[model samples]
Target chain A: MSKSQLNLTRIVLQDLWHNKWVMLLALLVVLNAIAVVYTSHEGRKYTSQWDQLLQERDRLDIEWRNLLLEEQSRSEHSRITRIATKELNMNRPLPKNEIVVRVP
Target chain B: MSKQAKRKQKPQLIQWRLYVVVGFVCLMFTSLIGRAAYIQIIEPEKLRHESDMRTLRTTSREVQRGLITDRNGEMLAVSVPVKAVYADPKVVHDKNGFADMRRWQALADVLHEPKEDILKRVQSNPRKRFTYLKRQVTPAVADYIKQLKLPGVYLKPESRRYYPTGEISAQLVGITNIDDKGIEGIENTYDDWLTGTPSKQKVRKSRDGHVVERLDMVQEGESPNDLVLSIDQRIQQLAYRELKKATEANQATSGSIVVLDVHTGEVLAMANTPSYNPNSRENLQGFRMRNRALTDSYEPGSTIKPFVVAAALEAGTIKVDDIIKTNPGRMRIGGKIVRDGRNYGDLSLSGILVHSSNVGMTKIALSMPVQELLGAYQTMGLGNYSGINLEGESAGLIHDRRRWSEFERATLSFGYGLMATPLQLARMYSILGNKGVLYPVSILKLKQEPEGTQVLSPEVAQSVMEMLVGVTEKGGTALKAHIEGYPVAGKTGTARKAVAGGYGEDYVALFAGVAPVHNPKLAIAVVVNEPKGDRYYGGDIAAPVFAAVMSGALQMLNVEPISKREKVRLAANSRSVE
Candidate 1:
């Protein structure tokens, strides 16, 4: 090997040995940057999950309201009366036919 | 040796150029520091706002209105979620050509509108950001439109009010407008309590228009508050059926029936015939929309006789059995003649009421001071608002005491000079059934019984009730009002309707009564206006309606028969009918 190139290699090795704390600090900075990237990505994932849940809740609420309205229309008095009198052949009994049996 | 000397001489000149280069680098560094300071300290707010505007968005959400239910928690009205179709004209014109006939035709067909009309509406306001294509479309239709994936078209969520009972309870429960605001009846009275507040939110969205983060709540959303009414759906249906049948059978112009719970003073049912269906309002007319029981008043005819008799009894001027002479069946006072159909000699007070003698009632009313009789009427809730919270309730007309001439006083005794609504008459009868305690009427269900004011002594009210009971006997005016299994107390009124200057040939047949007289569960009033049939008497028209409705109502409520004697009588009556 040439004498100057060999001398350059020795100088570099010596400098690295002397500045070990600075090298450790540089390694720590790079690790912290990686950690920041991972945490931000995880945060975005959770936020999207929350948004999806909220939308699902809204959809279910609307469905529940619609079902309640349906129940109301089905159980309306006029409709029930019509069905009872016409389709079921039911009629109100005479007062004389209704016997009162008292429960003891 | 000469070359080494030349190199050493040039090194000194190179040092001066290095100083110039160092000064130039220092100046550039200072300029960079100055710009950083300006951005960080001088105008930070503006820069931060600009960045936020690019990432953050504000959105608003609508909420549903509340439901209206009966006392038994049966839903009478409800709000259902719907969608409104809107479009941005500018966006449509920019994305698709302004003259895109195919797109317009597709939209028109989906909306059930003409293609030319759609094109005209969009082109008329080309600069507008938004225009409504259709409002209150069914969710299924909205979903179908969404699947079309048309540009510049969007669906916004909204709500609509629906009435389940249709025309049966339409006048009492009322209806809401297209914008979900109550326009009449109980709905109008409780509009604010039934509406819900909307909410606003701030969120951050990603590049693809998906919400990425919930930033903050700008306003909190409120769930709607439901309302519970005092009306019983079963009784309301019965009353509506009976009133409609009577009005149509008699060929009457209109009719009203009011049923009150005697104990609680709650109006169980108030129905008016010629009602419009709240669901479909395409051919609705103004005349058919009135809630006649509470909004219209007529001269109450013989319904006011009981109050005058009660007042006389209270003043110690007459007893239940005191005899009054009506031998001629007619009397003249101040050039106005009062008449009864037959000459009855020395009729007892109870017999007078049973016979509905106009001359007997006039003699009793004129014996008392005018102010005292007026006071009695006012105390009985006549000519006054019943404090019911329905919209457009009328306080029936009562003249000033100073204007009570002899003729007016005498006619008022027979129910000609003053007016009272059917609801007011029902309330008065309810007071008697409640043993003279006038409980405030309510349209909402009560959690506790309210305190009642003593309008008449209990003894006087009972005596009057006994006299009224005589009126439903075999020879009484309202024999048709009797239910076989219950004792009924009722008064019948057949008044000639007043026209422009004199009385018209038309009549208002009225019957106000309470049934199961021993316990008195219900007070009902029936009015048939201007019956065109040959038989227009209260006994023939209104009393039968009262009996039909009361019988059904009592059975529905499970009110027991008063006594075994009544049961036997009912069985015998049924056997006779069979």
Candidate 2:
């Protein structure tokens, strides 16, 4: 080999030996960057799932409110009273007609 | 071999062409780097914003108003999901939304609107952005409209308030406007507590409109809270039915009733006659919408007499058994003639109330200082708000003048100079039954018993309560208010309404009382304004309503009949004697 080319190879070997720790640190940084990208992707996937669950909760809440309204409409006090008095032939007993037995 | 040697001699020309091509390639690379730098450093926001606009979105979660329930958890007011159908006129015109005439006909039929009217509303202004075709349509109707697939017609979510009990509890639960905003009664007082803010969030979405990531929250959301009132719907319905029947039978102008729990100071029922249905607003009048029990005040008439007697007893002016002369009942005071229905001879304190003799009350008032009488009235919660926290409450006016007159004092003792609402009278009776402890009235359901102020001694209050019992007995003025198995202690008042210069011909019939003299569970007041028939007296008109409501309410509460209780007491007493 030529003298200049041989001298260059020797200088490169010396520099690599001296800066081995710096090269290792650079490799770790590259790995950390890749890990960051992987974690963010997973985070987004979980967030989408959580959002869907939240939507389901809202939908269930709405259903509950609607059912409550329907139940109230069906069991109105006036309607019950009307049915009891008119359809069922019911009446409140007078105080004199009611006989109380002591339950000693 | 000769040709190859010649081509090799021209190698300089080949090197020149190669240098030119390399130089051109380097120049193109430099220009590409320059453009990239310009976009990244010099002006990147525009392009970044354009990209974000296509992917990022601002989404909001909608919230509805909370519910209002009774003490028993019965729904008084509820919010149901609905939709508002709106049209973008410009979009309709551009998209030829009117191409399908059959769809327009169906839309008009479902909305209950004339086709021509709706078409004109949309076609009137093509540039108009938004116009409501129909508001507060049911979700079923909204789904039908959605299925039509008409362009430019969109459905927006909304809420509507529904009252299941209709006019039975309308005055108390109140009504909301078309936009689900509270405008009256309990709804108006707690509007902010019932309405909650919607949540806003920034999010990133995929191409097909799926949320990929939640960026950040723009505004925090709060879930709406529910309100539970102190009213018992059963008693309210009973009272309203009874009051409505009485008002119509007597042909009275108006009426109001208030029922209060003696121990908790909670209002059990408040009903008014001429109440309108909150669901339908057609042909509604302003007068029928008022909650007269809290808003209107009239002279208390003889209802104030019991308070005066209590004050006299507290001041030590008269003993419970002392005899007061009512013979020759008509008396003149300060150039004014004060007379009773008839002359009642020497009467006890109980007899005075039974006969409802004004002469006896006038003499009792004269025996004490005017301040003592007024002080007694003030302590009983007269001339003050009931602390119910409702809108448009009337703290019935009491004269605060510095000067005093014997006639004014006499008039005040008979309940002519003072004015009070039906709710105030009920509160006074509640104090009487609660052993002279005055509790603040509450419309909202209370978690614990509130602290009370000691206004009167227990002994004086019990004595007054016992004296009031005779007012509902056989010979008493309010015999109709007597319950069969329970002892009722109440007073009747028929006050002449004051008009322009002097008293008018109209009379306000009132009965305020507490029942089951042993435990005193409830205090009720019934007021009927201006009966057109001859039966205009408080004992004739208001007493029967009080009796019906009181008996029904007592039975519902499971209060024991006084007869059985007295029998048990007698058995215990005999065993002790044995």
Candidate 3:
């Protein structure tokens, strides 16, 4: 190689060595920006998952209330009595027919 | 000069200009850094809060109201989640005419409303933001409407109160309004305990109006406290059935029955006939809505005779076997004449109660101090609020000492001057059956034994109870009140209904009693208002109802029969049949 070309290469290498800290800082800044973007994206994904879970909980709560209401309506005493006396042909025993037995 | 010299001079000048430019650029960079530092460090929180305010929405969540259950955990009242459909009229109006018409038609079809009506409602106030399309729609209907995706249409979660037992428990469990607010009965009394507090939360929404994040709870919602009442569903149903039967059979105006726990002073059942169905408010009339057992008071006729007799005994002026002459069936007291249906010539104190002689009660009452009778009545919870916390409860009128005249005092002996609700009469009988210990009555379930005051000596109460038992025997006034295996002890009251000026032809038949006289567990009172036929007497009308209800209630409660006479009679009848 010619001396001028070699001299030019040496000057370029020296300039790079002198500004190595600035290059490292620029690389770090780019890495940090990528990390920020990735974490924010993950956060949004998890938040949506949490929202889905909340909605599921609300839906289940409503279902539970409905079931309780249904159970109450079905098990009402008056309804049972009506069914027993009407549909089942049941009748209360006469007082004279009821016998007392003591259990020991 | 040579060309090389010119180049060297230009390079030096260019270097000096470059230094000035670099200095200006650095000054600008420093200014920007300072401004950025000021924003990031000094006022970061304020700016962040301002940004959050714009994007972070606060929403209120409705908490479910608590359930009301009977003593055995049978649900009486419950709150179910429903949806309320609302519309933003302005949004509907902002659309073009065709689109708006299409939206209205779709919404109307979904809501089961007329399309023209919906359109008119929307256009009536174009500037109004919100209007209710429908309230308390089922979740399924709400889901269908939501799928339509009509602009400005929304479904908001709400709750509705439901009564499972319907009219049987209407007057006792009470009713709630459309907003899930308690308006009557136990619902009104325990509203605060049954109501739930709403919660506010912060949420982040996406562009499509989906909640993407739940930030934090601004305020925590409190789950409502469930109410455990003292009423037994089985007994309540029995009382309701019997009261309805008797009221219809007698063609009476209305009736009320109350069954109380003698030991706990807990009202097991309170049923009022002509009760309205709380679920539907369409045809509910004022008369049907009255909780007569707690709200209305009538002059309780012979029901008060026992109290006076007990007072006479307590004052030591009369003994259990002391004979008083009820000769000729009538006597004049002050200005009023008290009479019995027949001349029960002479009677022991127990005989007086058995015959329900008005003259006998008046003779015993006059022998005692007036204050003694009043004090006894007051101690038995007459003329006072029962502390049940029911709305519009009547403190039945018992005139004070200063207002007491000779005539008032005489009529008070026969249960004419003083008045009492059926519940109060039941409580009085409960006090007697509980060995004279007056327990404070409660409509709510008691977790522990209630405190009671000793109003009558146990001996005096025992004697009074014995006399009451005679009222249900073969020749007693309430022979129809007899149950097959249980010895019922009670009094029959046939009070002539007082009109505006004088007594009317109508009568209020009342029977107040306790069953299984050996170990009384229940105290029941039945009042039939204005019975039509020859069965207008308390013995004929109210006593039979008491017999039917008490028989079933005792069997349901598993109360063992302790009557020796009933056992002997049953054995004899069986032997004769064999």
Candidate 4:
């Protein structure tokens, strides 16, 4: 075609070749920015999960304490004695009635 | 060429309009740049703070108070998560919370309050921000209230301390206030150790209540510490039951019983009569709440006779075979006559203890130096703190005076001039049972046995312990204290209550002893005050309780019975001698 157009195209190619490193760096920076967004999103998701887990731990702890209290109440000494005497017809044997067995 | 010629004719007008338009556009751009610079440089914090107010939140984790268990890991005191129901009055009015009257009635029923009272508290102050509807309701009740879904009604978490053993250990484990603060007993002593601090953190939250980013921690959480006491629940229950029965049967005013471990000096059981239930907040009398084992002091009566004998033996003034001549039933000491029920004539040391003769004890004390006797008492841990380190403990009074009187010395020998708590008496007995090694008293469970101080020579202590065994044998003072399968070495004391300048009609019945004499395991003391009936002797009331508790405790701890084997061996040795 025209010699002037050919000269302009060659000059544009030389400029692009000279600035190739800068272009690559710009692309990497864009990719890093996108990566930052993705990681932050993932971090938030995990944090919420951890928060839920902490709540679950607290709930279980409360339940465990309640169970301990319940067990203690059920095994109370006075209640056991009452049950043993009234319901089961049991009593502590007298000292004379207890037989002494020696172990060799 | 033709267009250029035409343009040249209107060039002046075009030039004027272009200059005006350019100036106006430049002015608009300059103003925008100036505003941006002012905002960024001068007033950024205002908008930043506003954004933070919406997004930043400080969240805290709930921390419960610690647990208190016995030596065997049985729970004595526990904290259960509860809820404090409150209301935002202003919000209630705005949300028309009272529109549904049935919901309010249901809440009142659950809270055990009248509907009008609950509504009035909310309606009384419309502008008020907050008010408590109820404090420390159970989680089940809190859940039920949540189901009602009354606007402005809210429930926040709290904790409540509960004692499983109730009145049996009320005076020892103590009770906490509604705000979860320890107010009395062991709970008060270790309040700081039993409390926990909640953790706090700052986080950025999104619009949908999701934690978007974690920020710096405001406070690191500390898990609460737990406490393990040395008290055995089995022994404590047994002691309380027996003490309650004895006091009720005798119609006594009050009583206290203390059982100590002879080896470790651990207080296995300390029970007081007229104890109130810690669970119920009704009728909590001051006298009833007193741990009389450590707090109340009284003249120890004949119980101190054994220690006096031990002191005389230690001081080399009295020998194991010394026969003190007690002729008449009474002897005049500085115009005051100390008398026994019967004259124990020309008796050995063991006979004096068996008869519990006041005249016999007086003669022994008068022979020894005053300081020598007092020093022996001090070494045996008399009139001093029991080393339990509990609150409201009295050191009991011992007159450290230069001036002396003969009658005072005589009275001190029989445990009248000085005073002591029941726990001190038990400790002295424990020393006797432990072969003169005085261990520091412990209320908390110990992982290892602590070093003990040699308070008395092992020979003197053993000889004294053997002599005390006669008091529980046939025709001795404390016949009731004798166990069927175990030999008990104990003394009986019936101290007449002192009034203004003289004595009162009341008597303090007491018995202190150690059981299974071959290998002493437990030392116990019982004190009953002011029986209404005629039978106020320590042998009758207090000795029976001591026997019942000690026998049961030995069985529970699996201490072997020494009766059959010892008797058979003694018979065989006697036969060979014959």
Candidate 5:
């Protein structure tokens, strides 16, 4: 019970009441910042993932075109046929060229 | 003391009532706060994305359609990007207070259209926020309008079809509508393959109606497949040019030429004169796109005789050296008289083919049962679809053996009482050229070369092939078709048009020929509907075109010409270019 002790207790009590709201506000700000950062980070992933998938789709499309071209080249005509026939010994058949009798 | 206590009790009851009312109000307020938190904070993000879809104006993007190209990579039809000019009528009209200086007048000058046209288009929808003033505007014109920066003016993308080769090969390419929907030809037949999927995008807009950002593209559409045709552009142009000139020169109604690959049965080129550009499809009639090769059927005349001879030989009913007794050029069988253009003596099947003998073929066909001949014709691709790339086709007319009469069968032997499309004849000859194996005519390369169906024995086909070669020799019907350096096999079919159910003097001249007869490279079936000239025979009219077309194709294909004995004879006959 000294005079200085009494003065110090009164100061501490007033300061406690006055600065209480600051601590509460700091807590709220921390919570809100964490929420915004986490949500935005999550939202950003969707567009990037879609971008990667689109690139993959493009690669697939080019592959498909190449395959089609390859297939077409494989079965494509080798040489002009009528031209080959005239040069080769290929000729149309005739009636007299056949020999037959009744099977019965 | 009692009075004071009663007064205290009354005041205390009033205080209690007041406290109760305050508590009720606080409860109600708490309920409202909870509901607001649930809606505004808990589900706010979910609703926020949804509102962007509706309130935020997003652009609906359309994809470019696929192009139709020939086998040789020539673009038959393609779509070019265009812009549609639109305006907010309310914004434009209200901005221009003066009557003469109205937005419509400016628009009319920019559009180069009449004032009334601009006025009517805008005024009809005066209050509309956006109205299309013109569609399918050129990019330069649209760019100019965009530069004007007029209020409420907008440009939307559209598609316009273009035909690069003009009318050449137009019929097969087909036409598209104003919305780029295919209407006819290959366009309609393969619409599902050509229609690309439209991709949708969702964008977020700021409160002030300015675009804030482009979100993910939602509901991605699939791209349609591309169609590669089996058409040779050079051959098509050659045939088209020659046929056009010949048709105009002869004053013929129209003409058609079809060149087919012998082994694969691929339609190398199908060209018809009097064709129209597919780009201007609205003004064109169906006639302009008719594929006469598959649509028009006629008696093939001598074009059919080779088939009959081949059938007889394949059936083992005749031998190559078998003799057929005949007068010089005529024969009578079953009350129907058959004759050739010139007299031919008694000859074997080979000699008959060399002479292009109609009477000899008739005798051979009649000697066999009618059913056997009909079966052979069917096997050779007659009386059925040729399976060509043409949209419409005729099965052609060959009566069933059950309906066949003796005279009819005999006439059919020489290409009468039987009908065939040019496509069908080309296909039949293609089988003959393919060593008696019939392949489905392919306008495009299949995943694999279709296994051919056996229609004739290989030996029988070889022997018949020799007879076919004779038709292009010194005394052959298609002597003109013989190239000095290329051996050719062909038949001339001069069919008198059927008028009033009877034969008319006017004729459809046709030639169904396999070129380089010794090693058939191309089979061509040509038809001139009605040539108003001194020469109406297939040998004179159509055979020459076949020769020109095949020769040009050979040269383009870099095929080395094979000079035969006939070329020496031709050079000797030339007598120093006399």
Candidate 6:
């Protein structure tokens, strides 16, 4: 109601309209809110990806062991010996020539 | 004009709401388009992975094949753990995979192996999945392969068959293929049951690879059945070693020895020389694979003489002690010469048999009707399968009486035209050894046939059995076959092989005998085919091997010596008498 108070109110109104720096800051804050939500969702997606890879590794380990047993049940001695002696350079002892060396 | 003014002043609520509805539809359409684009193009793999995560891909865990065990738990054959190296040709053949190839070559060089071998293994495997490099690798070798960490390379477990005692009962065990399938032997006969069928099991696993639940219908394969043979390992070893020595010493074509229990009729041991190691099956000799005792046939010579003499006595044509004058070493019968070992004057039937007089035997056979003689041979079990367990068993050669030649009849009595396997011969004598009762032969089942009938009269059997004992006594033809502590009843036979319808210079020597005459235990048939020279008589060549085998067999059975003093006395008495 007084003349001094009326003059102060008018100055405040003028400053509010003229300040672009504060308005820009408010706009940036709203943009950052949207960015934060999107980035968090992406973080969760990658976390699940790492989890899926770990499962695959475990699956492969089990598969490898099972395949080994299957291969084992099917192998034969004659074939194994052929591979061992001819391919691997292992030799079987001759009955007539084998001699016992006394172990000290 | 007044109505138009009122409508313009108040905007219609329906039109305003229509604008809001269109805006909402546009927003929904935009969202749907964005979703389609994401699924189809922007992140196809990502979406597909998301869909696949709900699905579970599983495999079965393979169990190792079961083993075969023997009766006494002696490892006749077994499967041992081993490794096979394999490679994926597709991965190996990649264009930029040459870098890995160089690394592989360097590793192979460090392991002291040629790179060519590694390359060959890689090339051998089909590119689709896997190829074998080597099997039965040692721990150290497998470790080296693992350390190399070669890409597309893997190791697998495998099994190999091993026979502990080499070439022992090779025919009985049969053989197997590289895949552990029973290709031959007992393995083939019982393959499906031995290699159990596989089954599928469904299980839910946690994302961390821990199993959470197992679904129904998952079945593990059953193990193979165990087989216990009716053979004794110790007895088999005895026969094998002795036959090996005899065949080698005589430089004969091959040799066979079969020892059977007279009462039980169990073939305790069947051994053949010139056999191959089952572990190394390639380059096997046909002769080695043959079960000669059960498959091959030859003339019995004087060994069959006793059967005819026994037949005549049993038929009431002559008594055990009846006397007959034998021609001097040679006689012409049916346009063929029947020869004895030496000249003998008039002697009792039993004495004639003891000396192995072929001339006397021909006279006896000629006197009897051919029908009765043939019937007696049939009853004695010549020309019939002994029902052995091995493949390719022969029943020997027997010509019918309707087709008999007069000379053939005369020679057949003294074991010329009639041929029999060593097993058949031993089985025939086994009837005599078992008091004229015959039993069926089997390798799998240990049980015997129902109580057999009396083939010969009990008195006739006792007398003939008593007479056969003379062959192992001082004046008997097979005196060399006598065991020290136990009394032996046996016959020695040496017949020339008939080549081009006449006797060849080479002869087959055989000593078919039964030991512990008082109580017949084992009946053995020892056969040496085509011995080197003139000294190839049964008593000379085959009897020694018989003694060695019989000795080992007796010890193995834990049979007590009848008398220790008698053993020494008999040896002294035998050497002196000879």
> Number of the top candidate by TM-score?
4
Question: Which candidate do you rate higher for DockQ, 3 or 5?
Answer: 3
Q: How would the candidate models be sorted by DockQ, starting from the highest?
A: 4, 2, 3, 1, 5, 6
Off by over 4 Å in 4: A2-24, A93-104, B1-50, B90-97, B125-130, B220-222, B563-578
Report clash pairs, candidate 3: none
lDDT (Cα, tens digit) per residue for candidate 3, span B416-484: 977899999999998788999988889999999999989999988877876777787778888889987
Sort the predicted structures by lDDT, highest score first: 4, 2, 3, 1, 5, 6
Could you tell which candidate, 4 or 6, scores higher by lDDT?
4
Candidate 5: CAPRI quality band: incorrect
Q: Write the per-residue lDDT of candidate 6 for residues B179-209, one digit (tens) a residue.
A: 7777655566656656655455555445666
> In order, what lDDT does every prediction score?
0.85, 0.88, 0.85, 0.89, 0.74, 0.72
Q: Arrange candidates, best TM-score first.
A: 4, 2, 3, 1, 5, 6
Error of 3 at B206 (Å): 6.5
Point out where model 6 deviates above 4 Å: A1-104, B1-71, B94-98, B101-113, B124-130, B138-147, B183-195, B198-200, B204-212, B218-222, B401-403, B445-454, B563-578
Model 2 lDDT tens row, B265-296: 89999999889998886777878888999999
Instruction: Provide the global lDDT of candidate 2 against the true structure.
Output: 0.88
- Winner of 1 and 4 under DockQ: 4
Please state the CAPRI-style docking class of candidate 6. incorrect
If you superpose only chain B onto the true chain B, what TM-score does each candidate give? 0.88, 0.90, 0.88, 0.89, 0.85, 0.81
Model 4 B-chain TM: 0.89
**In terms of TM-score, how similar is model 5 to the real structure?**
0.76
Poorly placed runs, candidate 5 (over 4 Å): A1-104, B1-57, B86-103, B124-132, B147-154, B205-218, B401-403, B563-578
The window of 10 residues in a row where model 4 chain B has the poorest summed lDDT is B569-578
TM-score of model 4 relative to the true fold?
Answer: 0.88
* DockQ of the two-chain complex in candidate 5: 0.04
Q: What is the lDDT of candidate 4?
A: 0.89
Q: In candidate 6, which residue pairs get closer than 3 Å at backbone N, Cα or C atoms, i.e. clash? A: A72-B157, A72-B158, A76-B178, B174-B185
Identify the CAPRI category of the predicted complex in candidate 2. Answer: acceptable
